[model samples]
Target: MKSIIKKIFLLLPLVLAWTACNDYPIDEDGLLITTRSECYVSSFELLGTDQRSVIVDVATVDTVAQEIHAEVNFGTDLHALWPQFTLVTDAKLEPKVTGFVDFSDLDNPRQWTVVSGNRKVRKTYTVYLTVQEP
Candidate 1:
């Protein structure tokens, strides 16, 4: 009985290590195939007209509702050049916007095409930004 107990104790580490290993497959090019995540903008920040950088206070992603909410500082003071906003996403997006965003119209929503790392999945996200004027 003591020998059996010792064997069980010796095998416990092997069992635990096996259970903790993830079975992600790597391609011939040594790229992880299953580590890619869904495409979505994770965060957004803007350099306001006053030359102050401020992060969008409410950039939230609602996957269940398939929508994104963003807020920008749009006081009456910021009426000259449009504040340049930067967006970072989970995955690379195609047809990327090269220049700064011109926030002239405050109503229309913008769209982007998000492509997965494997190029097998594509998703669209509609970004709606609201101006918080006070």
Candidate 2:
């Protein structure tokens, strides 16, 4: 009985360490593929305009460290386009905006602008990311 108890105690640490080192595979919804890389843009919104607040719906994949571009068009004709805008995320991250654009040079639509508010906006645009299982 003493030898059996000694053997069990000796094996306990190895068993626990093996279990801790084991990583299980995962399965989730909206998972594109099982790979070491993935990128996407989740949601985008337009805030603070002379007309009204608007949200743009987008669904697409993006590569890591690459810019997730978006084009916003406000259906209002302003004499001089001057509207402050920002992109807010549902995540705990702070709101970010690309440097405001000067659309005064191009006159074609009611309102058309790019997402160049200030700095390079980086956030998990895609919500509920499906990280592929290893």
Candidate 3:
């Protein structure tokens, strides 16, 4: 009986390890397991003054390698305008940036929130826009 008990204990670790991995995610809020969307900004562009003109991509304004950056003409209105965004990995933007956005203060960085398609995770990104004055 003692030998049988020792063998059971030796096999217990292997059994636990096999059951550790699950095909589904943890259910904390009663939600089923689903594929989590990856956070990525595929395309970022600005609208031109001409309605029919081609869209211009926003470029980096900072010295460091930042994800989002843009350069705009001086005296441009930062408010009442929205940037066109193309996302990947089945992601969505928070605060519904599809509408107008306010960036009146260039000193402050703009915060954009990206939410997973499954609505399970949220991540924030900073956008820096530099004004190019002639």
Candidate 4:
């Protein structure tokens, strides 16, 4: 009876440890590993000074060309507008789209790079904006 209790105690920890083990992989950042590699910009939006969308129509996203085009209402201030992007699942953007960014220069379009979840693929996209004619 004593030996049986001793054997149970010895096997309890092994069973617990085995159950704790997981097959799921994790990256260096401690994020769950994924195999998805599809990376692209699905949508884009530009915000006005009042924090409202300045886009005149649905922004055009050219996945094949890796470019984005948006038209803003006439007289909309583009100097300090904010840009937002929607990307594929498990993908991330570089130059981290944060607070207001300057899109005042139309000739030199803004560029953003998207990285896949597996960190194996990258796509750089150019964004162009035009003001609607009054």
**lDDT top scorer:** 4
Distance from true location, Cα of 70 in model 2, Å: 4.8
Candidate 1 — number of clashing residue pairs? 0
Task: List residue ranges in candidate 1 displaced over 4 A.
Answer: 1-37, 49-56, 76-90
Model 1 weakest lDDT span, ten residues long:
81-90
Q: After superposition, how far is residue 60 of candidate 3 from its true place, in Å?
A: 4.3
The whole-model C-alpha lDDT of candidate 2 against the native structure comes to 0.35
As a whole number from 0 to 100, the lDDT of residue 105 in candidate 3 is 82
**Poorest stretch of ten by lDDT in candidate 4:** 20-29
Which lDDT tens digits does candidate 2 get at residues 11-103? 999998888555432223221222332222333333334544322343232435323333334443323333332322311222333443333
Arrange candidates, best TM-score first. Answer: 4, 3, 1, 2
Q: What is the TM-score of each candidate against the true structure?
A: 0.52, 0.25, 0.57, 0.79
Model 3 backbone overlap count: 0
- Tens digits of lDDT, candidate 3, 1-134: 99999999999998877776454454444444358766666667655434221223445432134257777766666765566767656667755656666766878877767666566776676777776667
> Best-fitting candidate, measured by TM-score?
4
Which ranges in model 2 have alpha carbons more than 4 Å from their true place?
A: 24-54, 57-134
Clashing pairs in 3: none
